[model samples]
Target chain A: MVIALCVTVALAIMPLVGVPKSWILYIFLFFIYLAMANMWNLLAGYSGLVSLCQPAFLGLAGYAMTIGTWLDIPWWAGMIGGSLIAGLFALLISSAVFRLSGVYFAIGTLVVPEALRMIFFLWRPVGGAMHGAGAGYMIKGIGDLSPHVVYWLSIFVGVGSLFLVKGILRSKLGLGLSAIRDNERAASSSGIDVFRLKLYVFIISAIITGFAGTIYYLYQGYIEPTATFNVRWTMTLLLATVIGGIRTVEGPVVGTVVVVFLYFLLARYAGYSLLIQGIILVGIMLISPQGIVGILRRSKFYDSIVKRMK
Target chain B: MIYGGDIITPILMGIMLGGLYALIALGLSLVFGVMRLINLAHGDFVVMGSYIGYALMRNFGIDPILGLIISIPVMFVLGFFIQKYLMGRAFAIASEIPLIIAFGISLIIQNAHQIIWTPLSRALNTPYSHMSFHIGERQFPVSYLLDFVAGILIMLFLRWFLKRTYLGMAITAASQDKRVAQLMGINTGRVYGYAFAIAMVSAAIAGVFLGMTFPFTPTSGISFLTIAFGTVVIGGLGSMLGTFIGGIILGVVQTIGGYLFGPASQMLLVYIIVLVILAIRPQGLFGK
Candidate 1:
């Protein structure tokens, strides 16, 4: 934990110490992705909710922030309001979606963002004319903000999400969640409020995901319905969470780094990136469903390190 | 402003559209009924079939309908291997594993289509592409009429096959209870393969019809998927007749919505109706 803190402090100070702008931008993306991936891990790995509607939260937040800026509302307030809206949306949909179980639940949640995308495409509340076939809005007064401020906010979110997952895991709610994940009926029968626990996790994940999304679009200075609510967001989260290690707190951290690296490496081949990632996802599920962290846990080196720590 | 013709026109159009939707959804319903697995790539498979028809038409000058002969067998072999090797193995690990694998397959297929086909929208131009027949004051496109006939014929054939054939009965039995069906000496694994293969055949047929009626691109699969999912949910899980009716209802609703709220809101209305149906009656109209 001390080492983690020291690293974060050092990272927080890097921009002030005259680090290259490109490095700062990369780190900013890393932090945003890390935050999103952590929340996804919390939902899918720990809570057993394989929600595919994460883009709904993220995009909604982006839209909210963009619209708010247009109306002269402050960016920070828009961020919080956007997150609350995401959480409220989750709360409203929970009753309907929670009725379905397992794969049904997955399918049910999958369509939310698609619906939101269409609604945004059709309803341009603040805009008068269409901008390139989508109801896109630009962040107002964004020229006055420095990149470093947004970068620090992303770092705060990234570090905050890591601690949130760690804290949740050690708490009673985490134990109840694991119980529900293992067996829903048994967990409910044993006095755990399955619906409530799942709802809590769902809403929390949505809020944090929204928070991270607002930060991202704020950095980008643009928000459009199609790109904001694309399924690619879910794809990235799934890839990062699955590759790093599901059900482990440290998994998303490691996974986010690899994903960010791959993002830059394959930036030139934009079309092939999703294709390669899909192949990797399938291959990993077939060969090692537990992912890289799972493979590491079974290795001799990990055993030796654990033995030494003990 | 409100005329009987206005109401009847959309309803008529919706029924024909519903017929096509049912055809696309049949494969999804069949696969899910037997294997209890939702193939996220089902729409992609439909798109693949369309692309196959397009290729056959482009290269050999064969009609899209005739090209189904090649596409069906090819898709059957593909689906069988995918289920037998990929999905079957994933099933043993976890229930959700197959879904994720299907998602992966969807991504691969969509990207592959974009890469190979260049993401440009293409339409299969049949000889009767612009041909339509008049019924009183209303005009019905020949392509839509053909799609409706094909959908009904396939649904009826599927019902009969399930009732009369040994393999079909085995699939039905396996869908009910895998353990009991296995105890009865039915090869559940092989049945799943057959079920998936049959579903693929249906997808191929639907894809050809879809190509005939609409222009499609690589990304069109996702909308088709949403339609199939909505149809299955509204119609219920295991009933073929229910699927047909559900498709009709969705078709009518979408048509009417588009008429009232412009074309952009057609899919949005379908989604809203799906959510409403899921909330009120999760089992669907015909589901037991």
Candidate 2:
């Protein structure tokens, strides 16, 4: 928690000394990275939904926020409303698609988001057609807020998301979720309501993702179907969670920092960037399923921390 | 508008186009059926095939059709190695990781293609490009008719191979149940690699045909991928016959959409069809 707070404070102060606007965008996206990784970890890592269609929820939040802005709601309110809208969509989808286990569920989830992207492309006014819809509201009072302020706000969201997730993990709901992940049949036999547990986690994951999406578009001042529903975003978040160490709290933050940093640095090169990212992922997954943080946790340095605490 | 020219021509053209789509999707379906790997780079192989065709023709004046004899085998070998080295391990991890890894490969290929070919579109540019028949009021491209026949023949041959050949049967068995097949003395990993290789061969051929039919560029495969995926899903998972029907439906849908809404909106409209179909039947039309 202290680490997260320090990271937030550092982000808040970075832009004052002549950092480029591109770096600020990168910083804003860094918080988004944290949120996305955690949300995915909650579902696939902890609860074992393993659904690959997290982008669909992101899309929902983006479109919902856009709709809210058009209706003259404040940006924050729009973001909250958008998050709720996305949660509803997740609930509706989880019931039908989550029936399949393992890869089938993952593939089903993937198809859902790709389909949603196409739907938005077809729906015109809903997705703002090809050019995409803007935030509809100009920033008025927030001009006094530096890039640091924007960065800190994003950090707060990321930290709050982590706590919310931590709380869920500590609750009875978390027990049910872990049980469902371990063995759905055994968990049901033990008197746990499996479907309800799955639904709760899936919805919670979407809600957090939606909140991130809403803030993302507000920061960018635009929303487009392709960008919002991008498969690349889903892949990035998944990589972060997996390579950071699935089913752990600190894993996502570590994973996101590495992956997001790589993305920002390499993204300018287009094709070369993809090659490097792909090789890195393939290498990581092959060598260590436990990921970087997982490996680190087992090391002597981390072991010493536990020894000291004891 | 009468005399068979206006309506028959477009419908005929659409059918041939649909045939091409089935050819490309065949590799996708086959790999998914047997290995359960999507080969996110399947489309990239198609892109590579086009470039190979373009290079052969541009540099050596080699016939585009003849160039396939070399490129197909080359791609097959490369794909075999990819499956053995890269994708083999990925199959053990959860499905999403492989997909993400494939996405990275796709990005690499996209850039590699950009660097090698430049980002500009290229075509086979053969003399037969202008060859077409005007039978009564209907116009037909000879190249397209040949493409259609080739697609059907390939599908029939694939069907025969899967049903008749010992290796093919082993592949099918492995796809159905790897552990059972392994228990039966089959090397599942070897079969998986071969299956993936064969799929890449199909994709390479489809790429040649795709370049012949339309201008080819690195980015062109992205939308084609959407359509191919839609057809695969609509036809049902791991079903070849279903892919054919799905491909045709996609073609007909796109043709009508283009007719009504113009080309600009055709992709969006086709994607909508895929979405609505999946919503209604999550298992897809031919899914078992």
Candidate 3:
């Protein structure tokens, strides 16, 4: 709670001093990524639904926002509207894809984006010949909000999502989710609505992911299929969530910060960054499969700090 | 504008492509059969194999066909070391951990290729690249015919080896029940290495065929990976015969979709068919 309060206060006040545009953009990007990582963790970590389809939902929301803005919808409403599109898509598709359990289910969902991207590439509605949602689509009245306002909007959405995931985990539904993840057959016999509950988590997770997509593109003021729907985005979030802590509540946030920090340092090197990040992922898995949180929890350094605190 | 003969073109071409696709998926099928571990880097290895071929042919001024001789053994050793050393550690961890590890391995390989090759697309530009024979108004590409023959030969060889060879039988036994096979005094670890090495052989061969068939770059792994999984899943995971069947099925789906729904829908249709198949039969057509 204190951490939350500090973050809220700091972000709330950071914009007043006329902070540089890039720093605001960095924090803004951080929030979106943090939210996404958390949502991915909720599905994969808690519910045992490891989906590469997160990018599909994210890209779907982005395009929906573009379409909404193209139709002159309010920016706020457009974000929500875009999220709804992603949620609905998930709702309709999950039943079919979820039939395949475990790794097959993961691969099944992975193909959806490739198929959809082809549709995006072939269909001329949004991106036209360029095979991406065009730059002409812009949110109405977005100009009135300063960059910091946009940044704070990201903060609100990001923190809200983490709380939402935390809220779910605290509730009975969360118990049901954990139950499903632990053992589906037992969960089913115990009278938990495993399919329905999974659907709910999936839709909710997609919505939050969709929201990130909307805010991300809205702030950037451009969208493209290659950029928006790229697998790199999924890899980034997956790496973050895995590195920070797969199942821990604070892991995704910690991971998002780590990734953003690394991005600032290594992104300029292009292919080298990818190679190093890949090495880091393998190294992390080899060294600590449970991730940074797991490492910290096990380390003597953390124990010493805790002993001193006590 | 839909000529009847044109239908045969996609069919013949897709069947040949399916032959090659079967080759691609078989490596994955072998690993999954023995270990139940999905090598997400399976496609990257194939691409890496292709890059090795590219380097050999470009730098040493060697023929594309002979390039496979060098690439195959090299890949075999690489796969052996990766399985014994890197992937060996993840086997003790959760099932998902290996998949993520493989993804990381894929990223490393792909970027490494990008760094070395500088993303300048390369293809085998031999005289036979476009050479084909016309048969009753339908032309068949000679290169594709050779690829199809190579695929069939490899499949036949795998079947023979499994039934006839001691090591192959050990691999089959190990795949069926590693613990039981272990009790029978079979060294499952070395068998896994052999199986992985064999899979690499297929991937290395497929890589050459792929370069000869199409223009390739460092990032071409994912597309091949998708097709490999698609074929494996469609053929029913763990079924060796099903890999070939699945490849043909996928090829037919792509070719027919292109002939009917425009060329862009070829890949889109492959995914759609797999999705529909999974929805209807999650265990796949022949998978138990």
Candidate 4:
């Protein structure tokens, strides 16, 4: 809640200092990524699923927002509605897929999104399949209410997602899911009901992802199957989680901020963006398995500060 | 909807196309089975193979068919060295490291290909390019026949090598368990190197066949890679026979789905099949 207040205050101050609208847009997009990376980290880093399909849920959410707007619904309600729909979809999928272990589950999750993209591409109601859905946006009273509003909304969502995850982790269901991660057989023997726990996490993760999609589409004012549900989004989210310290709350936010900043700075180059991300991901994993934040936490400086505070 | 022409031709094409799919997936299956690493760069390697074939044909006046022989060996050597130097260290970290590194490698190669070849799509042309034999009302390309025969021959040779050669046995044993292979006094690193090399060689051959059959852009490999992955999973990972059959199943799905639902729906058909299969038999059709 404090972090939310600080971010909201800071966002209000940014435009006063002559910051460009593009930078503000990038900042908003960064929060969308933060939301995505956090949700994925919670599901895979904590639950040990190693999923590469979170983007699919995001795509579904984005399309749902567009559809809802076209049908004359309130935009915020559409965002929540999209998230609910994605959550339901994830719940349905997890019941069957949670039975698989390791690679199979990873591969299985990937199939639905790819298939959904194809289905959407062919469906006529959502716009001419190949042409993609038109610019789907709801104009408020006066043209987007400035970039500051979008930035504040994004920050609220990002911090709120973290708080939600933190609350869940302290609850009984989170403990069961974590236990399922450590060893399914042992968790089952302990009467944790492994399948139910997995389904819950999957649904929760999907809802968060769906919100990310809605925000992305609203800000961008467009939806394309190729871009919204691209495999690269999955990879980017995974990279953020892995780089920022997978199983922690602050990890994904830090990682997403760092990577997105790097991507923006390096946008001019053709291949260097990918090259840098690849090197960072591979290098960090090999040298420090716990990720960049984990390294920071383990450092002597961080330890000394923590000891002093205690 | 299932007429003789619609049913028979699609199935036949699917089986024939499965041969090509098997070739594309062979490298991926071999590397994963042997090294326990999914080389995300596997698709890029195939893309490199297409370029190699193109280079050989354009420069030396070699037919695209003969280009495979030169390209395959070069890819093998490249793979061998890549494993010895880069991938060997990745094994020390978690399995995900290699995947990230390989994905980076994919990006690098894709960009390199774009720079070298430009964004243009190229098709291999030969005297036999348009030649086809008519069977009943359906026409089958001669190149497809050659592709099928070559795929089977390669699989047979691979199976024979695994069963008969010392190095092949070492590769298989290594894949089964590195500790066991090490305990048997095998140089586990060398087996990994050899296995990665052979997989690249197969990928090179697949690339040549794919290039000959269709026009290829640098980005063309992504769709094929996805399909190949779906095939490998359905055929059951590490099972050669399963990979072969899985390719056909995917091809059949694509062809029939294309016929019935339109071209766009083919991928959806395959994805749905994978979901159902994974839900029912997560181990895959023939996975160990």
Highest-scoring model, lDDT: 1
Q: Rank the candidates by TM-score, best first.
A: 1, 3, 4, 2
TM-score of chain A, model number 2 = 0.87
Per-residue CA lDDT of candidate 2, range A41-103, in tens?
Answer: 998888877777888887788777776666666667777888899999998877667666665
Best by DockQ: 3
Candidate-wise lDDT, in order: 0.88, 0.76, 0.83, 0.78
Task: State every prediction's TM-score relative to the real structure.
Answer: 0.95, 0.87, 0.94, 0.91
- Alpha-carbon shift of residue A132 in model 4 (angstroms): 5.4
Q: Residues B211-250, candidate 4, lDDT per residue (tens digit)? A: 8777889877677778778888888877777888888888
What tens-digit string does per-residue lDDT give for candidate 1 at B153-251?
A: 999999998889999999999999999999999999999999999999999999999999999999899889989999999999778889988999998
Supply the TM-score of chain A against the true chain A for every candidate structure: 0.93, 0.87, 0.91, 0.89
Candidate 4 chain B: minimum summed lDDT over ten consecutive residues — where? B1-10
Writing each residue's lDDT as its tens digit, candidate 3 over A155-262 gives 988889888988999999999998888889999999999989988989999999998888888887756665666677888889889988899887898788888877
lDDT of 4 by residue, A135-159 (tens): 2233232244455556677877876
Interface RMSD of 2: 3.4
Supply the global lDDT for candidate 2. Answer: 0.76
Candidate 4 docks at the CAPRI level of medium
What docking class should model 3 receive? high
Question: What clash pairs does model 1 have?
Answer: none
lDDT of 3 by residue, B1-288 (tens): 132555788888888888889888889988988888889898988888788887888889888779887887788998888888777778777777888888999999999999998988888766786798876788777778877887788877887887799999999999899899999999988898888899988899888888888788888998899999999889887777888889888977888888888776778789988999888886678788
